[model samples]
Target: MKMSQTQAPFARLLDAPVTLGDERGRIRILYEQGNVVLKRSSSVQGVFRGLHRQAAPSLQEKIIRVLSGRIYDFVTDPDDSDGVIWYREITPETDWVHINARYAHGFYALTDVEFEYFCDGRYDEAAEESYNVADTLRDALNLGAIQLSAKDSAGIPMSRPVRRAGDN
Candidate 1:
């Protein structure tokens, strides 16, 4: 996973999920300016919530190794609802495989619902599992749904599907 330009330096810092500790893995590259640490806690929060603070541990590393100026395509699902999720792939060596093997495998295989943020506000930012978690990951990050170009990375990965309470 190396970038295209080695000597020119990246246009901007980009972050990628890296295997580290147990619960709090690692996010390398610190994309956002000034944020140095990422934190995580199992609390209910809505997706796309406006100006909400996230709890995931902020991962930081001095710009060193450059991999895939482009985020690899190993985390996408080619099937399911609208194919809307964006997931990161994990394997046995990676910490996430044990965090929840079922979900991790599904995400890697595109058989599970991936997490996604929609509406750009509290209405659908980080909502919990309404559909299959495996399926959700795939839907929320699909190229057509989020429409993120192949050249960039998304702010968040699709860990599960989202929905409102009054749905039929």
Candidate 2:
């Protein structure tokens, strides 16, 4: 389903059909796209990962799916005047989320979780940029005391300029 146009950083949920199997696990086709890279992440409860994105020339459009457990997923456009942060509660049963390349993406694991995403572009270390979730979305999230990786802990504050490799 599409979100309102008034929302900054366009994103939407995509429906997937699941085929049930007798005495076996189910099969669900999340997405099918050629030349996409797949990434998987496993996070324990109370862990927060990202508000991360790559800059232009290496930007990636992503399709995210929760393989197990639950999370509060978020996406935002750093350039938007309103600084709007769009979020949703996602689970294995939820529709997959498609986020445009311009938005930064992140999630807070509400329970032990395993999730995967398909990216249209390869990862570029020099082009990576991230916002400090604690600094940017602490008040908005209100989920006390989340853990962050060292790289994520050192993320740039949203109030400051986001610098890419080629920026002067």
User: In candidate 1, where is summed lDDT lowest over 10 consecutive residues?
Assistant: 42-51
For lDDT, the strongest prediction is: 2
Over 89-114, each residue of candidate 1 has an lDDT whose tens digit, in order, gives 32222222111211111112221112
Model 2 scores a TM of 0.71
Give each model's whole-structure lDDT.
0.25, 0.73
Provide the global lDDT of candidate 2 against the true structure: 0.73
Q: Model 1, stretches more than 4 Å misplaced?
A: 1-24, 34-168
Window of ten residues with lowest summed lDDT in model 2: 159-168
> What TM-score quantifies how close candidate 1 is to the native fold?
0.18
What residue runs in model 2 are displaced by over 4 Å at the alpha carbon?
1-35, 159-168
Cα lDDT of candidate 1 equals: 0.25
TM-score of each: 0.18, 0.71
